[model samples]
Target chain A: MKDNKPEWYARMKRGPFEVTKFDSEMMRKVEERALIDRIKPRKKRFSPWAAAVATAIVLIGVYFLVPKSSLSYPDTQEVGAGKSEMTAEYVREHLKIGMAQEDVKNIFGNAAEGQSVKRDFAQPHQDDPNDMRTWTAVDIWRYDYGVGEGYSVHSDLEKDNGFDMPGIENGNIESQLVIVWKDNKVERAFYKYMSSKGLESTQIGPAIEDFPDTEPPISDEAKHDSEYPSLEVRAIGESTLGKFELRPRKGSAEKIQPLGAPSCLGLDTDLTITGDYELFFKATAGGESLIQNYEALEIIQKENKAIMMQKFDFPKVELYLFIPRYTDCHGLEFYAYGIDKKTGEASAFTFQEGDNAIPYWTTSPMVLPTQLDDQLVVEGGRFAGTDGATRYRFQPDLNKHQMMLEGKEQIP
Target chain B: MLTRDYLKYVSDIPTATLQELMEEHGQEVWNYAYFLTKNVDMSDDIAQDVFLRAFLHIASFRGQSTVRTWLFSITRNTAINYRKNAFFRKVTLLEWIHSASSASSAEEQYMSRTFTDTIWQLVLKLPPKYREVLVLDAKYELPLSEIASLLRVSSGTVKSRLHRARSKMKEFMKEVERREG
Candidate 1:
C-alpha cells in the first residue's frame, strides 16, 4: 500500500480480505521444518577407524579423488580399543573408488539425498591453448550428509553486476560430506568444514584487513542454527527418504536385492532377509476378489512378540508393525510396513533416512477412502531409547513430503 | 523496513521472523496465488508454501531483491508448480466435479466471486508468462527491473510480455462487446 501501485489496479484489489484460520497449521509446520533443518549433522561423527583412515589417507601425499591403482595400508590400532572390529590395516588396503553405493552405505550409512550432477572436467586444448576442451561428461551421484549450508550476506550487491564481493569477508561457513558416484561407483569424496571466526585468531581464511568496513552481524546465529535445536536426536526419515514411492513394489519380484541390510558378514556380501517371513492372502475390502498383501480384517496379536497387525478400517490400509530384530543393545527400532495387497509387496514404512540419528518419513498417513473421518493419519513413528511414546500426526502437503511430527509449537 | 532488516532478522533466528513476514505480506501473496490458481484452497496452500520456503531459506536471503519481490516470485513459482502437478490437477478436477455436482443456487453465487467476471477470465486466458507479467505489473505494480529480476528475464522481455498481455486483453474485450452488441 505504501509504494505507488497502479490506479486501475485498485479496482482489481479483490478485497473483503477474510483471513483463513491456518495460523496453527502454519506454525506447527514451520516449527517442525525448523526442527528438521536443525537436526542435520553439523560435525562429522566418524568411527575411530574411519577417522584414522581419512586422516592417514589424506596425508600420504594423496590420490584422494583418483580412481586408484592400489591402496594405503594403515599401521595398526591397540587391541580392544576400538568399536570397528576390522583392523585399520585391513580397511586401508581394501577401500577404494569403483565401490558399489551399497558398499559405501555399509561403511558411511545411507546418504541423506542423492542428486545427479554433471561436471565438465575442462582442459585447454593441447593444439590450441585458447580452445576449451572437455575430457569427460561425468555423471555423478552427489550424496550430501550431515552438513550446515552456511549463507553469505551479499551487501552492496548493487555495486557489482559481477560477483566480486569478498565471500570470506562476509563470514560464511559450511560443513558437508559430498560423495560423488559415477557408473554406480564412488568416484570422488569432498569434505569441507568451515567456521566463522576473527581473521586475527582463525587460520581458515584471510586476515582482518582483508574485509571492508561494512562487517556482517556479530551473532553466532549461523553457528547456532547450523546444528540441532532440541530433541537432541536425529530425525527419523522425518521427511524425504529412500527409493520413495517411485517404483511400485509389485513388478514381478525380479531378483532378491537387499537394500542396505549392512553386510555385517563381510564387505562384499550383504545381510539378506531370509529367516522369518510372512506373506498374506486376503479378500479385498470390497470383498469382491482376492488380494495378496491385504489382511483378513482383524487385529492379530501374539504375546511377547513386538510385531502385531491391526486392521484399522481407516482407508482399509494393512500395516505390519514390527521391530528390527537387532541385538537389544540400543532402544528397539520399530517400523510399520505397508502392504500393497495387490502386489503382495511389503515396503518398510521408511521413505528416507539420515545418519542413524536423523528422523525421516515413510508415507503419508491416510484417512479412509469413503468415510473421511477426523482420524489422524500416522505419517511415521519413532522410538527413542529415552523419550517415551508420542503420536505424530500426518502433516500432508506440509513439508517436502508428508511427515509426522510430535509437537505443535507456534513459531514467532 | 527494507530487505536488509529482513536479512538481519532471518540470520539472527530463522524461525522467529515468520510472524512479521506473514503479517506483512501473507495476504498479497495469497491473492496473487488465488488469481493464478483460481482455486481458494490451492491459493492458500501456495501462499503458505511460499512463506514456509522463505522461512526455511532465511539464511540464504541475500537481500539481492526486496522481500516483497522475493516472496512474490516464490509465490509465482509455487503457483505455477502447483498447477503443473499431476496430483494437483486430479484434486482440482475432483473438487470441481464435487462442487459442481453438489452446489445449490446460493452456493454457486458465492463461488461466482472467484474471478467470474469477463476481464478476469481474459486475464486468466493469457499464457502463463504473459499472465504472470501482467499481474505483477498491473496488479502488484512492480517495476520492470524488479519484475525482470523476479522472472529471471530481461526488462525487454518483461515489457514485451506485458504489452502482449494487454493487447490480448483488449482484443478479448472488443470481441466480447461486438458479439454482445
Candidate 2:
C-alpha cells in the first residue's frame, strides 16, 4: 500500500477542478432592460395605395402579354377551326370505313372509271321516314403497267427457255388502287391493271361491305378459346409508338394482364379470362359526358380470333357497361345488348345516365371515417364558401353505397 | 422572478462547491472555447452567449444529458460558426503563445517548449473527428463518456478514436525523438 505504485496512481488521478468566476449580474440587468423596452399591441395596418399600384401593374402586364388581334378587339381569339375537317393525313391516321368524295380525288389524282349509283339508307330514321336522301355519282381509279417488269428487266431471257417476258410470270401487273365516294361517303373502290383479257373488271363495293369476310377459317371453340373471347376493341397487330404499365387496385379480385396492342378503335387489350369478368372504366376527372373521350378494348381467344363487344361512339354522360357471354349474363337493366343471330352472343347490361360516377374531388378528400360522414351530411367547414359546398350535397349514385365521417363539426 | 439574489446565489457559492457541483462548470466551458478559438476575448464572448442561450431555453432542456455535455455541445457549435466566419483570417496557437510571451518576457512561448511543440504539431495534423475528442480530453480533462455525448457518438467509438489519436501522437513523438537524438 505504501509502494511507489500508490503514489503514481494518485498523481494520475483526474485533478480537482475549480469553479468558474463568471460575473452574470451585468447580463441579468441587460436582459431586464431589453424586456422593459417592449410595448403593447397595435391596430391593423392598411396600404390601399400600394394595392392599387400592384393591381395597375398586373393589368398592364396582362394587356401586353395577351393582346387581342382578332375581330373581337379586347378578347382572345379561339384557336383552330371549329368543325372537324377531314384531311389525307387524318384519313391515314383514323382509317375509318368511309372517306369523303373530295379526299379520294386528292389522294388518287384522277379516276380510271367514273360511274353513278343510287343506294338507300336502310338504317333506322331519326324523325321522318321519308327524309332519306340518295347519292348519285361515284368514281374509281386503277393502275396496271407491267409492275414486276422493273425487277426482272436485266435478267437473262435465255435461262428459263423464253418464259413469257422476263417479268411477266403469271400475269400480275403493277397498279395503284382507287376508292369512290358519293356525297362525302365511300360507296365503292377498285384496282386498275393491264389484263390480257381486255381489262378484267373487279368491283370494290362499300369498304366495310368489301372487308373480305372469309368465315374466319377457324372453329368456334378455337375462336372462343383463342379469338372470339379476345376483345379487339380497336386496331390489333398494328404498331403503337409506346407501351404503358397498368396497375390494378389493391385487393381487386381480378388478375390484370399486360397492356397489349392498340386497335384502330383506340382501345388496348388489357386482360384475358378463364372465368367471368366485369371491366370498369372511370374518368380520371369530372366533366360533362360529351367531354369524356372514347377508349377501345379487345379480347382475343388463345387461337388468335377476337370480337369487338363494346364500341363507344356516342356521348358517355354516366357509366358504360359490357358483359361477355350475355346468355350467361343474369342481370338485364338499361342499355342495349347485341344478340348476334348468327352467333347468339348476348349479354344483359346497363349504362347509368347523368353525373352518377363518384367524382374525384369528393371521394378523394374524405380519407378518415369522420370526414366521410361529415361529407355525406354536408356539415364540414372544409367545403364552406365554395362550389364544393353545393356539389357535395349531390351524392353520386354508387349503387346505394354510403360512407360515414366521425369527429367533425356538422354543416349548418 | 430572477433578481440580484439569484445572481449572487449562483456567484457567492464557493468556487469548489459551484465548480464541481454545477452541471456546466463555466470555467471549463470557457477554457474549451478558448482552446478552439485561441482568443481570450472571443472565448469570453462565446461562453456568455452559451449561458444566455441556455438560460432562455432552460425550460425546454429535459436534463437527459449532463450539464457539461450540453454546454460543450453549445460551445462546439458556436466556436465552429465563428471559425467558419473567420476562415480567411486564422491565427495558430503557437503564434498566439508567441504574442502572449512577447508581451511578458518572463514566460516563454509554448511553441518553444520542445514537448509541448511536438504534441501541438501532431494534434493539429489529426483529422477533425479525432482531434476534437483528443483536445477536449487532454487539454480540458473531459471524461470519455461525456466527450462521446458532446460529439453524439458511442463511448466505445470515442475510446477507439482516442486510442488511434494517441498511437498517431506516439509515432510523431518517436520521429522527433529520433531527429533530436
Candidate 3:
C-alpha cells in the first residue's frame, strides 16, 4: 500500500486496461441472445378504478364550462375592482428578462405615451443630429394614465433598490421623486404619489442649461418661461438592479435634492447636473416593489446619452391575477430583467400565461427561489437596501394571488 | 409497417451484434469499476451491470456525447452505488482485507508476484477521486477530454486529479519498498 509508483496507477495513465481475448469472449456469452430473450415483455392492463376516475374528472370539467346565469353572483363593481387588484399582482409575479414591446403595451393599454431622448457621443455639440462618429443614445419612457400608473424606460431605479416608498408607506411620500442626470446636470425629473391616481397629473421642465447669465436675477416671467421652473418632481430611475429617488428643494428654486440619494443611487449630491439629459417616471398602485429583489439594469452609454435596460429574470412560475373582463388578458404579462454583475449587460424577458404555464399547483405558501439553493446568486439583492424586502408589493389581504416555480422537465 | 421480415431481421442479428451496436464498451467500463471496487470480480460484475442497463435504455439515447463516455458514466454510477449499498459495504470490506492478506502471503511464497500485487495494493490506497482518474486513463485508455466530459468537470480538473493520483500512488509505493526491505 505504501508503494507510490503502483503498477495499476501507472497503467491508468496509459489508458483503460485492455480487454483480454478471454474477457471479450466471456462478455459475449453473458450478453448474448439468451439474455435479451429472457427480458420480460410488458402487457397493458385495464383497471375499473382508473376508468371511474376518468369519468368523474370529465363530468366535473363539463359542470365548470356550462354557463349558469341563474347562480347567485356578487355585485359587478366590487368584483371588477377585486379583479383589477388581482391582475396587478399577476403582473408583478412572472416578470422575466427581455420582455417584448407589444407585451408592455398590452399590459398597460394604448392610453400610455412613449417618449425618448437621444444623447449623441460623436458631435459633443447638442445641435449635431447626424454626427456619424457619435453613438446615438436613446431613452424611451412610456406613460399610461388609464392604468392609473405609468413607467418610463429608466425610472425603475428606485424600485430596484428596495425602496417601495410611495406605493407602500405613507408620510414618506416626499422620497418618491427621481431625477435623471447627463454629463452631471439635472436632465429630467419624475415623481410618484401615494394615491391610486399616482402619476396621472404631472408637469414637465424645459432645459435648464439653455439659459445663461441669469444668476440671482429672477423675474416672474423668467421663472414661467424657463424649463428649469417647469421640471416635474418624479421618482429617480430604477433599473432592474438599481433604485433612485429625487425630491425638489423646498421653497427654493436653485437647490433640489434627490430623495434617498447617496445610499440608493450612489450619487454624491442631489441637485448637480451639467449636460443634456432625459428622464422618465413610472407609478403603480398596490403591486410588489421593484426593490428588495435581485434585478439587473443595463446602462449602455454611447457618447453624451445613456440607454438604461432593465431585465427581470424571476424563476418560471405560475401567477394568477384577476382582471376586469373588458381589459385584455393578453396584455397581462411579466417582464424579467437581468443585470450582469461583471459586464452590466441588462436583459429582459416577458412571460405570458398562455406560453409559460405553471406545471402544477401546491397549497404551501410561496417563498423566494434564492432561499432554496446557496449557489443561486440573485444580482440585485445586494443593493436591495438593508431589509432585503421583495421588489414587488401587493395590497394587504385583498388580492388573492398564486405564484409557483415550474419543475424542470425534459422537452417532449 | 409491421412485417414478418422486420421481425426476422431483428431476431437474426446476433446478440453480440446487439451489444456491439448498443455501444457497450467493455474494457473502459470494467477499468472504471475496478478503480472504485478495487476487486477484479466485483469490477467485472459492475461492468456487466453497466452494459445491461445501457442495453435496456439504448432507445432513449440521444447522441450528445460519445458512446464510450456515456458507458463509462453509467459504470461509474453503478460502481459508486454498489459501494454505497449496506450489503456491498460489508462484503467488499471483508473481501478486500482477505484478498490483500492472501496476496501478501502469496507474494512471500513467490517473489515474482510481488511487483504486480504491490502495485494494485498501492492503487487501492490512493484517494477515491484520484484513483478513479488514473484507472480511467491507464487501464481503460480513455482520453483526458472524454474523461473530463464524463466526470462533468473542466479539463484542468481531470489533469489535476490524474497528477494527484500519480503522486499519491508513488508515495505509497515508496513506503511499501521501505517496509518490505
Candidate 4:
C-alpha cells in the first residue's frame, strides 16, 4: 500500500460488458429523424425518384458547363475509363478533404492564372530566391460558382476577401473555394457554403461535402441511395456581399476589436485538465473579456503588450484565456502561447500595433495548437501581412519545454 | 475485397449494418463508459450518444481508423463531456458503485465482488483525466501517442499525464491503507 505502484492495476479485472441484443428500435427512430429532418424547400422540389432520374439525365448537360481555359491541358484521359463526364455536382459530392490536385482539375477544368498558386507574382518565386524561406511548396487553387453562370475559380470578383492573392490588398473571401496542395496532392481544403439565405444575415460553415478520404468508394452505397442523391447542403453557393478592411490605423494599439465576429475564429474555449482544471480560451480581445470567461486569480500582460494571460488552478489543473488586442485588422493578428527557448520560461503570444492600409493579410483564426511545434512544424502555417504571405515555423529549442522564433513571430 | 452481405445492408439506414457490426461492439462501448463513469445510467446515455455519432457520421468514416478505435474515441469524448456537466457532478455515483458485481459462481463472485469494491474504488478516486488515461492505456491498451491524439495533447503531455495518473493512484492506494490500517 505504501509503495508507488498499486496492486489493483495488476489485479486482473473483468473486461468490458457483453450485450447480446442491440436496441435496433432506438437506432431506427434516430435514422428516421435524420431522414425526415433533411426535407426542405430547395430539395423538396425534386422528389426522390425524380432526383435520381434527373441526375442520370443531367450528366451530358453538366459536362458542357465545365469552364475551359487556354492554359488547360486535356485530362479527360483520367476520367474513369468508360465513365461518363462528371458534372460540377458530381465533382462537389465526390471531392474529399485530402484529394489529388489532378483529380480536382480532372473534375473541374484547367484552373485560370489568378486562381492558382502559379499566379504571376510581382517577385516570381524563381526570380527572387533570396527572400523566400524554405517551403514544402503547396499549390493553392480557388474556385467560384455562380447562379446565372457556373463554376470558375478565376472569375473576376467585384470584391475578393484577399484570401488567395499573395498579399492583402483588397478583397473579401466570399464563396472562396480553397484547396491546398502538397507533394502534388490535396493537403487540406476549406470550402465555404452560405448556410441560410432566407435571413438577411448569412453564416458560412465548413462545406461538408468532400471526396471520401483515400478509401476507394468500393461500395455501391453511392449508386444504391437515390434519395440522398445530392450532398446535404441547405444554401450551397450564394456568395457574400459586404466586406471589411484589415488595414491598420494610427493609435491602432489602443483601439482593439474582436478578431472577426464572436462566431468566426474570434473566440474559442477549450476545457483542459493537467494536474488542475482549466478552461483555456484563445481569443482576440482584452481586459474585461478575460475576467468574463474565467474566475481569475491574476491577469498579466507580458512586457506591457496588449495580450493578457489569465491563470486559474482551482478544481485542479487549468484554464487560460490568451486575449490579444488585434484592434486594427490589417497590421497584426499573429499570437502564440509558448515557452521561451533561452530561459525555459513560457511566453504569451499577444497582439501588436500595426500600420493601416496594408492590403496583404490572411484571415486565419487566431489559434495556438496545444502541441505548438508538432502540429505546425509538420503542417506548416503561414505568417502573412499586406506585403506578402510567407512560410512561418515554430522551432522549439531541444531544451524540451521552450522554442525559438523570428521577430514579431513569437506571441509577446 | 468481396463486399459482405452485411455491408450490403450497411448502406440502407446507416444503422442496419452497424446494428450487426456493433452487436459485439456495443458491449465494449457500454462497459468502457460504465468503467469511466462508474454510473450505469450515464454510461448507457454516453454509449447511445457514441453510436448515434457513429451512425450520423458514417459517411465521414474513411476507414482511416478502425471503427472500434473511432467508437472509443467518440465514447471517451462523450463520457468526459457528460461527467463535466454540473448536474451529473452533483449527483451521487455511490449507489451504482455498490451495485458492481453479480457473478453466479461462488469463487468468481467473491473475486469480482472484492475486485469491484477495492480496485475500482481506488480507480474512481482518481481525477477524470487520470481515470481516462489509465482506463485507455492500462485497460484498453491504447498507446500513449494515441491517447495524446484522442485528448488533443502532445505525446509528451500524454506520457507525463499517464505517469502522474499512476503515481496518483499509488498515493490513493496508500491513503486507503492508512484509513483501514
Candidate 5:
C-alpha cells in the first residue's frame, strides 16, 4: 500500500478515466442545444422534434409563398434559395439518369456550392495541351444533405482532435446525393445514406430512404457491377469447422507474426484493449482465408458508436472497418463493415443472436479466432456464462465475396 | 478561460466561448459523469447536458470556484438526476467487472490487463460514496476542501471516505494477487 501510494497516485493523477480525445459530434450537439436555447425566449425549453416541426412548417410556407419566377435557377442559386425539397425521396422520385444539367437545375434548384464537393473527372488535352477548353472532362458533383445538422466534418476540428480520413472525410456524413455529368448530360446518379451508427441495415441502395421498409430499387448497374463487394460472416456447421484450417498453406500462420504492441497508423486510432484481451483476425479475400493477428483492445464505444476502426493504407488491406460497439448480457457486442477504399462502397459481416444481428462480442476477456484455424471461429454465444467458448465460424459466400455469421453451433 | 472574465456577466454565452469551455473541461466532466454513472450512453447525455446547462445559465455561475469544478458540480447533479428519473436504467458496478469464469479465467485476463486498468476496475467496484470521494482525491487530485464542497460534505467526512476507499482498493488488489499466485 505504501509503495502504491507514490507510484499509484502518480498514474491515477494522470487521469486514465479522462477522455483524451473529445467527440466533435457531441461538441456540435452541445453547441446546437445552446444555440437553440439562446434563440428561444428565455428559460423555455422545447423538444428538438417540436422545434424541427415548427421550423419545417415555416420553411414550407416560405417555399410555397415564393414567386414562381424566383424558383427558377439563376446559375448562382443555392439549394435553400429555392429548392427545399431536395430530400432523398424527392431525388429518387423526380430525378432521372440522363437529365440535362439545365433540366436538373430547374428541378432541384442548384447545389449549394459551399457544402458540395466538385471534381473534374478528366485529364489534359492530348492535342492542345495549353488549351484548357479542348480537354474532355466529366463534372462530378456531390451534394451532401443535412450538412448544417452536424453531419459534415469540420476539417479544423478533425485536425485539432487528431482524427483524419483523407478520401473519406465524410466519416460522419448522414446523407449524400452524387451526380456525374458527361457531355452536358447526367451520366450517373446515386443517393447514399451513411449512418453514423455504422448500421449496415440502414443502407438499402442508392436512392433508397434511410431505414426503408421496402426493398431498394437496385439499378441495373448495381446488380451486375456493384461498387462494393459483399462481406458475409456466419456460423458454419460442425462439418466445415472440423475440416477448416485458417491457414491451410504450410507454415503460413507463423509466416506473419502478431503486430508488436497493437500499433496503427491512423491519427485518432482507438486500438487499446481493455486489459490483456487480444483479438486476431483471419483476413480472407475471394474465399482464401489468410491469417493476420490483430490484438485490438476495447476502443470504448463513445457517443459516435460507429467509428472508423482503422484507415488501412496497406495494399493488402485496403478496407476500413466501422464497428459499432454494443454490449448485451454476453459482454461487448459489435458488427463491422469492411469498406472498400477505391469504390467508397462497404461490405458488412454480422453475427446473429436471437432476433439481433450482433456480428461479434467479446466474452469478458475478448478475443477473436481464439486459436489459429482455417475458419474464422469467434468464442462466445448465449451459453457463454456457463458453457464458454461457443465457437461460430464465418460462412463465406465466395461468389458474393462476403463472410457472414448466420447461426452458431456448439463445438464439443 | 472563460471563467474569470465571464463570471459576473449574466448573458447567454457566445457559441465560440462555450465551445472553448467544452474543449478545456469536457473530458473531466465526461469522465466524472462516467465515474458516477457507469453507463457510456448516460455519460454522453449527462456531459452534453452539463455543458448545455452551463452555457445557458452562465448567470448562475459565481466566481467562487474554478470553471472545471463548477462543471464537475453540474455533472454530478445531472448524473444524480438521471438516476432518479424513472426512465434511466442503472447499470450496476458489478456489471462492469466480468466475474471469473472457468473458460477465460480472471487470472489469465488480469495477467494481460495493464495495472492501470485493473486499478480502475477495482476502484469502480467500490461503493458509490467511497468511489466518488476516492476518484476526486486520486484521479482528479482535488483538494480536500474542494471535494468536500463539491460533494456537500465536511472535510472530516471526505477524509474518512477516502481512507476507507483506499483500504478497500488495497484489499481487493491483494486478493487479486493471491488468486494469481
Candidate 6:
C-alpha cells in the first residue's frame, strides 16, 4: 500500500528526450508512406512451404521448418532438431483456422497449457436495432514448448507478473502457440519463439478480417420465431427458443444468446421473455431431449429477472446456469439449474439462507460460479448486514442427478 | 485533446483528424518510441510508422480505450517489431554507442545551458518493463488500468513495477550523489 508518488516524478514530467517531434515535416512523411502503402498491391499469400523457406532464408540458421499441408505429421520431436518441438513451422502446419478444441488437443497430444473464455460485447447503437451488440465469445488456448530451468531477471519479472506477459523472455524461453477460438472454431492462431536477439511471432495463416460487431443475419427457420410476444417450446425439434416471464413495466425482454456452452447442445440457447408470463427451459440435442419442458419454478418464484444464461461443464456433465440481471435484494444473486445431459434428469442447486434452504444466491459482491474438482462453488456476501463473503459448495449425488449444498465457509 | 470531434465510426481517418491527432499526441508518441529504443533516429521512424499504421488500420480501432492509450499500444508494438528485426537491431547497436556518447554530451550541454535533471537519464537506464510503467504513470499520468491494458499485464503488476521502478531510481540517484560527492 505504498501509494505515494515520488517527488522525482514531477521533475520527470518535463521529458528529457530531444527527439524528432511529430511536426509538419514528420507528419507529411508519414502521410506519404501511408498513401504509398494503401495504393501498393498486397503481397500474394505465401503457401506454407514458401512461407517456411522465406522465414528460413530471412532468419538464417535460427530454427525454421516447412509446415506440412496435411494434418498427418510426425511427432513433435521428429519435426525439428535443436529447437523447441512446437516450432512456428509445426504450429502453422497442424493448427488450422477452423479446428475445434478437441481437434487441437488431438494434434498436440494434450489439452492446452492454459485456456480461458471471454465474452466481448460492443456498445450498440440505440437507433438501429440491427446495430445491437452481438455475442462474440473469444476462447483462447495457449501451448508452450521447450523447458528452461534457471534464475534470470527477465523470467523472474515475468513470473512475478501474471502469465499473460508475452514477447519478453530470457534464454530459457518456451516456444509459445496461441490459438483464438470463436464459436468453438479457431478464429486466429499465432506462434512465438525466441531468436538470439529477441522474440519473434508469426501469424499462422492469412490475416483474419475483423467482423463488425453487429447482429448476424438470422436464418429463415430462426426468423419464423423472431416475432415477440409469443412462446415457442420444442421438445424434440432441432433447436428451440425459451420464452420466460417478465415484469409488466420492464418493456419486452431482449433475446440474449447465452455465453460459451458445450457444442453438444448443437443449437444456440436463445432466451426470449415476451408478453406471455410462462417460463420454461427447452434444449434438444441430436434429436434427443437434453432438457425437456423443465419449468423454472425457482426462477419464477423469485421476482428477479434473468438476463442471460451460461453453461459450465463437469467431468461428463453440462449444467446450464441462468443469471438474474437485476436483483431487488440488497445483494446481487442468481439461480442455477443442473440437468444431466445424458440421463435428462434435472436438479436445482440451493443454499441455506437462515431458516430456509433457498435457491442459490449471493450478496453484494457476486462471485461467479467455478468448478473445483467435482463440486460447483458459488460465493457471495455483504447482503443486508452480512460482513464477510460466504462460499457455498454444491456436491452432486452419486447419480449426478441432484446437487446439495455441502457446506458454507465464511471468507474474510 | 483535439477540440474537433476527430474520432467517428469510419473505415479510415480524415486528414483533418489525422493532423489533429498528430498535433495532440505526436510529441508524446515520439518520446515514447525514444524511451523504448533509446535512439532518436529510430524514434523518428517509429513515430511516423505508428501514425501511418494508425491511419491505415483505423477500422480496427474499437474505441475500447482512449486515442492516446491506443496510440501508445501501437508505439510499443512498433518498437517491439523494430527491436526484433535483425537489420534494425544491428543498426541500433551501432546507434546505441553513438547515442550513449551523445547523451553524455547532451547532459553536459544541458547542465551549462539550463537546469538539468538526471532522473530521466536513470529512467532510460532501467529495464524496459519498469521504465515503461514508470514513465507512463509519472509522465503521462495514465490510470493504472490503462497502463495495464497498454502493457497487457495486470494492474497489480503495473503497481509493482512502478514501486520497483521508483525504488531503483532512488538507488540510482543515491549512486549519482555519492559519485558527485
Model 2, span A160-204: residue lDDT tens:
111223233344433323344445576544333333433222223
lDDT (Cα, tens digit) per residue for candidate 4, span A1-412: 1224345655424543223223655455445544543342222345667865775565456557655431122243322222223232233444554445654665555532233323344532232111111222335555432211221233332222213321111222233344555566664443443323210111111223221232222223223334222211101111011111111122221111111112111221211111111223222232111111111112111122222333322121122223332222222222233322232223233222121121112223333323232323211233221223333443333333222333224231
Q: What is each candidate's DockQ, to 2 decimals?
A: 0.05, 0.02, 0.05, 0.05, 0.12, 0.14
Give residue A148's error in model 6 in angstroms. Answer: 47
Error of 3 at A249 (Å): 50
Model 1 is docked with a DockQ of: 0.05
Residue A35 lDDT, candidate 2, scale 0-100: 36
Chain B TM-scores of the candidates: 0.76, 0.58, 0.67, 0.70, 0.82, 0.85
Q: Point out where model 1 deviates above 4 Å.
A: A1-8, A14-24, A39-100, A103-412, B1-14, B35-42, B77-111, B114-119, B175-181
Candidate 3: tens digits of C-alpha lDDT, residues A1-412: 1223444445434333323312765476557623743454521233757745764685466558754331212222222121222122122221212333443333333333333355544522333111111224433333311121232223332222122333323322222322233333333333333344332211122211121111112222233234333233222335433332222233323212221122122222222212112222222222222321211111111111222222223343111211101111011112233333333332222222233322121111122223332111111221111223223221111111223222322211
Off by over 4 Å in 3: A1-25, A32-412, B1-14, B19-24, B97-121, B139-145, B153-160, B176-181
Question: Candidate 5 lDDT, tens digit per residue, A1-412?
Answer: 1113435665566554433534888899898867766776573345767765774685577579987655543333343232233444356445655556766666555663321222353642132211112324435555544443333343211121111122123444444455655566665454544335321111112222111111122222223223222112211111111111111123211111111121111112221112112122332332333222222222332221223342223222132233323232333444433433343333444444443444344432244333223244566634323444566655433334344565566655
Estimate, for each residue in A1-412, the C-alpha lDDT of model 6 and write its tens digit.
3478887778987856544356889988777766666676543458878876874574353323434333323344432223355665466555777656666764774535545533443542122111111223334666545544442212111121112334236544466566666678776665666765355555543232222112112222234335433223311111122222223222332222221121211112333222212334343432222232222111211111334455666765556555543332334555555655565444455554333355546544345678788787877644322346777787655363455677779886
Q: Which wins on lDDT, candidate 2 or candidate 5? A: 5
**Local distance difference test values of all predictions, in order:** 0.41, 0.36, 0.38, 0.40, 0.48, 0.55
lDDT of 1 at A351: 28
Error of 1 at A231 (Å): 65
Highest-scoring model, DockQ: 6
lDDT of 1 by residue, A1-412 (tens): 1234434455545542334434656656655755655565333447768866875666454556643433321111211122223321223223344566655544444432454423343532222111111213333332222222444333221231112124323424222234445577755443323233221101111111122111123223234322312111111111111111111123221111122211212111121121112232232332222112311111111111222233322232334333322222122233444544344333434323221112222221221111124233332322222232233343222223222332332211
Task: At residue B57, give the lDDT of candidate 4.
Answer: 56
Ranking by TM-score: 6, 5, 1, 4, 3, 2
Span of 10 residues, lowest total lDDT, candidate 2 chain A: A236-245
The predicted structure with the larger DockQ, 2 or 6, is 6
